[model samples]
Target: MAIYSSTSPKFFLSSASTSTTSTTAMSTTKKLKRYLELDSSLEDEIPSKKKQQLPRRTCLVCDVEKGTNQFPNHKKVSSHEHDHNVCDPCYRSHLENEIDSKGWNEVACPECSITLTYKEVKNMTTAENFAKYEQACIRATLAADPDFRYCLSTTCKSGQLHPGGTDEPIFRCEHCGHKHCIVCEANWHQDQTCEEFQAVRRRLHAENERSQQEVKKLSKPCPGCRVPIQKNRGCDHMRCSRCRHEFCWVCSADHGLIFREGNHRHEKNCIHYRANPRAQEPELPRHRIERMLEPDTRLRAYNRGDLDDSDFDGSDSDDSDLDDTEPWDDEADLPLVYEPDLILSEVRRRAPGQTLSRVYVG
Candidate 1:
């Protein structure tokens, strides 16, 4: 026999490790099996039980569908109490006072394929039940009536279950050509999977796309002036000050009144002045007068240094004759008029009618 040491540390350690691993593996396996069983049992039992317990529904006003074990049980009338299964709500609905109101007609429940009169639905035993029955009848009738329905989407046509847990809807508006999901009564487009509320959304989108394409295809010049034509690129409206043109973004045609004409003159003036400073000049002097009548005599009279009173002696007859016969070339054209004295007395003696020429002459 091989020599075996009972107290060897290596053997003891190996044994302990194997035991721990085996225990762990066994526990893990057991936990896994338990989980599998739980999953299978839930799948098999719970859903089936749920389905069995779910309420069976039948239209109260019509003979459409009848589901069992549903809540909101209806009681039969006293006349038909023996028949507990009878839908009393449906029976009482046949005697409404408004049967004649608005030409009440007999409408069939589309869901149950049973004819239900409006008078029957309106005559529910209780007000609350009557309202409920009436609503159900309306839904059924609307679903069956082609006039009230639109077309079904492909998804609905293919019978895809709605996310809402109810029976799928089958009714749609005939005019709009829209279909509502059976479960949620939610409408969806034929091409898309998402639920939509408005039927016009797709149409509106197409119209908008068409409009954008038309706008893009159009090639008109800037309405403000005959420049480049980039429609709706920046602004819709433009104002041209050069030609006073006003127009939409596309057209380059001469559109007047975009800018006012009155200010062009001022603007031109300003520009001209800015470019050529000399364009703006001041006015000429306005006060100079011509001294043409008296010439040298007036000049000599005004010039104090030229002559004195000796030139005009009052009593000198010889000087007087000389003055009258003077050979003055400058005064030759002037009339012969003279005074002997050249002082204030002479001016005082002159008549009021005497002008500057006459006064100086005298």
Candidate 2:
């Protein structure tokens, strides 16, 4: 009645198109539901099947084809329009070998031979090895520098040196808290010039040699104790103060020789018995005795404004007017507290060009 024809071409075409569209929509909804269910249960199941399908990577060092998991600690190098990768173990081995053989300056990549940056090398090395590398670098730098000096204090032998070209002769060792002369390389000789100090040092050395020779000539060993003794003015019969064993000074024999008779006589085997009776020499003059006993007084006089330019040339006419007192000995009473901040500030004030970038305290 309403022109409904079963064989109509328009109606057949519209029905076919609608059926195709509905079927496709239903297929898409079912596929979406399946995907949601799979995703929801993914945590409970082993995902190795999916991971196995992932792309495999080739290690540049070992030339082995491995999954991404094997290169967990890989290092990347990008330079000169090229990219490179090294596995962790291989990178560490290469860095360590380079450091042991050629130091940090020659640390390089095994494949490309290009020098590795500090950050790349540091990441591969251990903490201890990194510290050693830093120290080696510093030592190399110091070795190259001619003006560098080491602190002479035995306790704290720091490698810090004061900047040169300053008028100040005295420089305090920041590590040991000891003051030293930069020119003479000794304890600070504040009062005397470097030349005067050197002259005094030479004279002292000569006097020491002469005194040793005099001791060898004048002194003999005790027979009982082996302690050296010089007979000033007494009989040849000697008693050792250390061992209290009496013996002859000339022949170094037992005291029985003198005990046999009240008179002092040398034994027959004594070296000086026949020609000389081995009597002790006369006592030294009072002035000579004083000079030998108190050599420190004359030695200290140079620092006390007592010794003048004339005394340096063997003229000892003027006596020291200053009292015999050692100022440096009082340093022993001072407290030894290490204040790093104070030392750093003081060093900065004294040497503006020097910079203390790193400090290690144990």
Candidate 3:
């Protein structure tokens, strides 16, 4: 501090300025040289335009070959190495299946935002399983899918896409343990490992297993007919295919009692049996029907035109003005009786009070 006082402030300032200028020049020179070296390195790495473009690997899913530049990276399992030409759909499907079987609900493509199941990932065939990372790069032009545009997130349920990236876009659902992709709103990416997510996946696996068991239980065919069995109610009554004898589906034993009307149970010991009630003979309806005959019913004399207008009206109640027309003589030769029993009768075997009746005219 005392040394600065011995020197003129202007002189010191000038000297310091000169030193600063030199340092700036040196720094600038160094930066320029560094930039030149980087440029040279970059040029060396890239091939000339005249160089032939490498052929793209074929995608395994869609079976389309794409350029190498389109691929993101390749992959390998253990010591074995193989080309991953699989398309995005096939890969996503494979991953998804694997994840699901392990109980993972959602799996995102490591490269793309596509969602997949755990089963899809692990069950990949030997060919798909052995793809090299570079060859399997999902970014490859072959990975494009035009049909699928929606995000794969199970929780999002939002079907549309946004123009801009997500705000607070990259979020992990603490409840579901799913990672949401900003662009697609699809869940699959992971910024960090989550124990909660794994637990959720395991729970899903258990639930799936339970579902499969339930399906198996419901899929049993009827022992009697070899047809699919369905439980109408909790009773064990069942019938046969060709015979349809009332017996328990679990044990082929006769139902204890004869069938009554309106009982739902078909158990072996069930009181509900009637030689295959569905095979019962159809019955006709019953009602008494009688025909009445009037002596002058259709005679033309009954016609109002046969009488004078005064006779037809109340002003002329005299029957003397009426015309006496003879009935057709051919009627004498016609049979006096019409068809008999127009009203059908049906007896009730189940309930005596439930006899059905039908009325008819001929």
Candidate 4:
């Protein structure tokens, strides 16, 4: 392209350069006219100093009217809609409260029951807090596995799932080189059976009356897992350190979220619980309701003894009334304690090329 230039490169100015010089001259003329106040045409073109700011919303949290930007993540996202009700400060304070309570695992919006997604949680929290949440999640996931166990050593805080839990009782902690008896989930028993260890423990317990009295005075058994928990100094809302079971220290009742008048988090027997006559189930979206009927979810519920024949009656469900007596084409409705289908599914997962029907969730 450069071989066909008729004029020498230095002698000829580019068309772009000529256009730029003319544009600069015109801009200078406009500025001079503006300064002289000779032209009123540009007066309307100049933007006004005061902007007509609107779309301000009242924060449901503080009842203070603030700008749209004050709301945290106030946009139509996959997890939630544009929430203009809660301000950024209030929303962040809510997150901090949840984090401090050690309930950052399943933090829901203050406005709704919709759980915060992983990315949302990360964005709202500090890196340290986010890492803690990640560790909590890992612990919870491991806790779901029957073979998982924490190391017995006092100094070591590591835990992992030991394969063949029922078959092999010896669980050696790879983190601290500590050995533990899987059957009893206690310190390693050297040259002794579990029964023998229990007998010895019983005898030792009988001899130590002072320790037992002190324990009885300070600690109480968690209704969920029967693990003994001590309350040093805090509110009646006690959460078991071992099982993570929330319960009232006074009544030793399960600390489930109660939607009653006084906003109770304990059983009716407990003083903290206050019943509301008009209280009913909090309404969720139809999609969320339908998602509960997924195969794997239903199966897990069945395994945990949370489902019954009545739960399968989708026809009676409010808003949905779905005719899904058989919710999924899987063994979700099966009531067997030990399922062979799980083993078969594991086999299929290991060997992907196999043509056999695998037990999969919807």
**What lDDT does each candidate get?**
0.44, 0.64, 0.46, 0.66
Q: Write the per-residue lDDT of candidate 3 for residues 149-248, one digit (tens) a residue.
A: 3334555432332334444455444444455565444465465334555667779999999997886687546555666555656666666555565656
Please report the candidate that would top TM-score against the real structure: 4
Give me the overall lDDT of model 3.
0.46
| Strongest candidate by lDDT | 4
* Candidate 3 Cα deviation (angstroms), residue 103: 12
Judge candidate 4 against the unseen true structure and give its global Cα lDDT, from 0 to 1: 0.66
TM-score-sorted candidate list, best first: 4, 2, 3, 1
Off by over 4 Å in 4: 1-51, 73-77, 102-105, 210-362
1-362: candidate 2 lDDT, tens digit per residue:
12346676442346667788899999999999999999878854657766878767787888887666554243444342343455566667777778888977888877678787667667667777777778778888886775666776777656664566346667787767787787888988878989999999999999999999999899987777778888999787788889898887777767765455322445667764532222333332333322323436545676567776675454435343546632322333233243444333334444568545443221
Q: For every candidate structure, what is the RMSD over all alpha carbons to the true structure, in angstroms? A: 33.4, 31.7, 23.5, 35.0
- Count clashing pairs, candidate 4: 0
* 10 residues in a row with least lDDT, candidate 1: 283-292
Query: Cα deviation in Å at residue 259, candidate 4?
Result: 53
Candidate 3 residue 52 Cα shift, in angstroms, is 7.1
